[model samples]
Target: MKVIAVANQKGGCGKTTTAINLAACLGKKEQRVLLLDLDPQGHCSLGFGVFNEDARDLYDVFTGEAVLEDIILPDVFTGVDVVPATKTLQAAENLPVRRDERDRLLAKYLMPIRDRYDYVVIDCPPSMGLLCFNALAAADLVLIPIEMSLFGMHGIDRMYDVVRELRERHGRDIPVRVLPTLVDSRTRLCRQFLREIGERFADDVLPVMVQFTVRLKEAARQGLPVIAFDPTSTVAVQYGRLANETMSMLQDDAATDGVGEPATGLPEATAAVQHNNPANEAVPVLQSHATPGGMEESRKRLGTMKRVFEEARSRLSRQGGLQKVVLRFYDFTGRDVKLAGSFNDWRPDQGVVTRTANGIVEKIVMLMPGTYQYRLVVDGLWQEDPSNPEQVSNYSGGYNSVLQVEEEHATEHA
Candidate 1:
């Protein structure tokens, strides 16, 4: 099975939101998906519409009090199963001391049922504790959500260090991708931050951006993913796209011996290649969903809406209501660093500072009124902030970069 841990040291960076929506979208495509809620807050479980206050959850499974089969529940979305979380999980902070094989607890629990699902998505708690470590240890890949802000950049270096250490010590080489969440493209600062991420990370970044939308908040309030609540919304569409990309990546990995190969082979030569291709290979066809006469009109309308949104946002930014934050990094450790969070598209970027003049690399960014989480890019690293005292750690023992914006500025923008 392809396992992914959705982890972000900073809270409210849309980690649970992405996990719920991505899983739901994958399920809609007829993929068997298992979502594990490793967070004590149980936001992911609630997002799946599963509310059992006393449910036996990850806490029980990790503590050896319950089996995986007993905790797994079918979600409202077809082909999706969930291991819900409960308040008892808050005590999981102390689980490492109680168990001899604490770090591999989650991996051991999931191994038995690995073949049962096509994808296993874990929603990790915001803190870097034993629970988060277990999730990372179990995962073949990791997705980090970063909030686009100066502080967000500060946290990525530490996370990278942890991931690197795990790979080296545990022999678990997990590929990680950083994703930007809650993006507001209208802000120049947001756009600049994205551009910087792209310049730094290069091919490690995903092409899609999950824009900030009110529909996301509404879905959260309704205890559902945007895809389940409003499939027509932009957020839902973007999540669906993300699911498709993830599935494609998994399939590619499987085909290349990353997993195992399919068991059917009738031909051993060029005929097998020909059998996979058809006459359509050499021809390009245009597919259109719009009526011939209405296509141009629809395009014009979309253009108008885009211009209107940009105009309004520009006005707001110019009124001193919101300031842009640009984060730049130079990795001095001679390794690649990935900047992940709610800001960039959750892909690895060059934000790594390989050569520095004064023994320190820096990034500057402008942010509007709000709180955000981010991490640094060290020699191909992902880490949290070390200098900030208000920093919070994730369940994986990684720190988070945090930023708090002024309320007055937020109101002015509104």
Candidate 2:
């Protein structure tokens, strides 16, 4: 099953809306989908016409008082199930366990039903607390809903730091993709921000942006996903495009391994691509190393490097929350290295890996609390870091290493 969490630290970013609509679209396409409302507001449940004053909700699951089968309720729309939310979610902060343990609560609950649905979409609250951490820990991928405002970028660095910490410490490899939502094409600032994000994120950015539209509100007011409420609307069309793109990515990811199943409900050609295509070979690895100044260096890098910046937790009395995971590349000869990847637009200079005092090349990056897969760029070549033992070969035959950050309550909560 593919579990996706729609999250954003900044409020009013359309995170809940995306979760509701995206689940609806997937269901409309005949795919089995489950929408888990992690937000205390329970907007997702209300959007699907399943609100009840005394319903058993996600809170039951978190505390182990209920199982998924008991809380799941059919929505007005067919093929979609919802696990509603209640005010109890707000109490997560007060749980007796350590903070990191709270993040694993959702994962423990979902473990039982992981394979029941084709897609599990989680709608997260607007803070980096136990609730959001639980959603992140339970998710296979994270969809960050970014608004077109200047402050939109404010907490993103912190989010990245959390993701990195989760991966390096926990060994979870969750991939995160950013989605541009509530975009106002008319505003120059919005347009500029979109362009900058596109240039900065490149392929990591989704092809379709959710434009600011009245229809979105209309659909919400009508208590239906945008696709069902108005399949012909612009927002609906954009959502469809996003769904298709997401399916394509999953299929591509599966092809490298003999594992991933083809996406149902797509055209024959699309399905073919989604399935294994021997013709599509993995790209060659790049060369990377670190320099003396702690910067990462990549040799023969051809694209722009996308850097995901995040905030470092404060260290009032004890050691700081966690240090950033540094990515450095070294040549076979142990010389300084360069870096390249989907984030860096494959450009060598984007993330220059610097050498260390002990002759090690490295670059430090702050990632959010999740798992991340990356490779190194050596002298004009791309390859896995021999210094690190955790590596996996993608379907493309390229090597990738997994890094995990421990959620505040991962162990205690689990």
Candidate 3:
């Protein structure tokens, strides 16, 4: 089985989110997946609604109280089993072990269950502690989920160094792939950083990206993976692509293991650049990594990726120039709520409200720079936004919340 550890030192980069959903997506394809939660916060188990305060975790195994198989929660999600973690797992770092064996503890434990599943997806903690090292030491492939932001790239070089150290120490060549998460292609900053990430980590960047969407957050609150929550959602489709790409890379690695060749499934330095200066033009970022033979398939894959991106750009061109505007309502305890405004012809059916983890009801709508009037329909009662003080009197007795969106306010809260 191929063990993929979803790791990044950066927080809020969708590491756990990727782990949970990727495992679920892989399971959807009839692949047996074991999701191991190495995070002390136990967010992965929580995502699957399987968190138990009294259940035994990896902490018991580390201290010789239990074996790896004993802590497994079988069938948490279809075809996915979870080895849950708890806050107690953090204490395993302090276990006294020989210097040569500390990092390989997880690897040693995983030996017995290596062939039990088709894939093992690990949700790693954000810190570079013993837990993270143990995970990296055991990983066949390390998938780094990098957010498309300035600070998201921080400590990436250090992470690369850690991976190099593991390769040298363990005498195993573990491939690393960068997956850009929470990307909003419409924003100028997102597009710029996406291009920069592609150029900088060309050899490691994956072809697919997880676009910014509020539905992911909504899914988390509902304790389900994005695919299980809404299979037709864009993020769900993107994660499905990610699972396929990951399997391809792993298969290529297995096939080329004895030949001393790199996986050709991952295109080196080829990025589909989406630009708005020309208004809906897809540009290919050129690189010098092209080879004469065997790597020809990489070029074909890159061309196909560019064509797919171009089609996405064509779709975006129709609704391309709009900025994101988030309308928030608090203390909403209704079965359903929706936004009706002039932006969408004041149709409530077009905008469905989503509640976040913090219990804040929100509706994200795209609009051009202009002033528009909107109201919230909470279970059948029309009301103004409680958070926004700006309002104007409508023809009815109540007021309509006035939202003024500008180009400078291109902040996307999704």
Candidate 4:
């Protein structure tokens, strides 16, 4: 089975949302997906409508008190299974030295029944703690979710550093990729930052983007993924695309290895990543290194970085937020065009539907810098936006169009 960890050192970057939805989307494709929620907050269980926590969970699994087989539950969705977490998992942080063993524990537990599922997706906590390390240790691929924010950008460097540290210690270079979330195209700053990220991460960034959408929050409230809640929503479709991209990447890796799988042990997979990178840091430096300027200097640098991030947040906040956005749909000859989304609480009838020149349909509204999922109702028939390529499965036999209202001068469309 391929292990993919959805992780980021930054909180609220859509990590849990991505983890749950991606697994659900993969399940929709008939791929057996097991989502291990290493997050102490236990959002996965909540997503699945399981309010009652199991007395035994990942805490037991990690502490060797319970077996994974016994703890694994499939109540989340049809083809997706989940190993939920609880507050007790926080105890993992206090795990002692020789931590690489703890890191490797996930891999060890997963090895026995690894082939049962096609993929094991782990939702890691938003910290560089032991739990995150364990997830990284077992992962074949690390997917980092980054919101379009100042703090989000700063965490990327720290996340990279953690990956490199793993590479140096384990002699296996873990491949990490960034997935931009909550991307608002309406903001000039958001758009420009995205461009900068594309230039910097380049091949390391996933092609699919998740727009800021309240449907994600709604789905959680309904105890379902957006794909299940609104199968035709744009965010759901984007998750589907993300799953396909990940599968394709793995397929290519297997072919490259010529061994029918990404070379057996962790070292081989890491080495493959190491060999594949041309633009990233080279191999020699990937080796173990001494602490640069000792612990005190590292602490001082971290303080400086914190201050820098604060300044960045202040600067970016000014450049982002609510703006006048125009939602337009073109080339529609339908009777009336209505819009429904979270902005209007998904009320189809109350939306202002107007017909513009050249058969162009449009709705002008002020929106903040975030992702939103909306669909056009053309003559009483709900449809995905023709002009907007960003969409997700609404699970209602249709699709909801995605719109990113960036924090720019305005006039952005979905």
lDDT of 2 at 284: 17
Tens-digit lDDT track of model 3 for 136-166: 8777778999877434565576678788776
lDDT of candidates 1 onward, in order: 0.64, 0.62, 0.73, 0.70
Cα deviation of 395, candidate 3, in Å = 65
TM-score: model 4 vs. ground truth: 0.65
RMSD of model 2 against the true structure = 15.3
The candidate with the higher lDDT, 1 or 3, is: 3
Give residue 90's lDDT in candidate 2 (0 to 100).
Answer: 59
Candidate 4 local lDDT, 44-135, one digit each (tens): 88887774565467778767788888888874687898988887786766655363375677777787667778888899876566778778
Model 3, position 350: C-alpha lDDT score: 72
Error of 2 at 180 (Å): 0.6
Per-residue lDDT, model 4, residue 237, is: 76
Question: Against the hidden true structure, what lDDT does model 1 obtain?
Answer: 0.64
Per-structure clash totals for the candidates: 64, 84, 0, 29
Best candidate per TM-score, number? 1
Can you write out model 1's per-residue Cα lDDT over 228-270, one digit (the tens) per residue? 7898987788888778766766565553211232124322211
Candidate with top lDDT is: 3
Off by over 4 Å in 3: 255-414
Supply the TM-score for candidate 1: 0.65
> How many angstroms is residue 194 displaced in model 2 relative to the true structure, after the best TM-score fit?
0.4
Minimal lDDT window, size 10, model 2 = 281-290
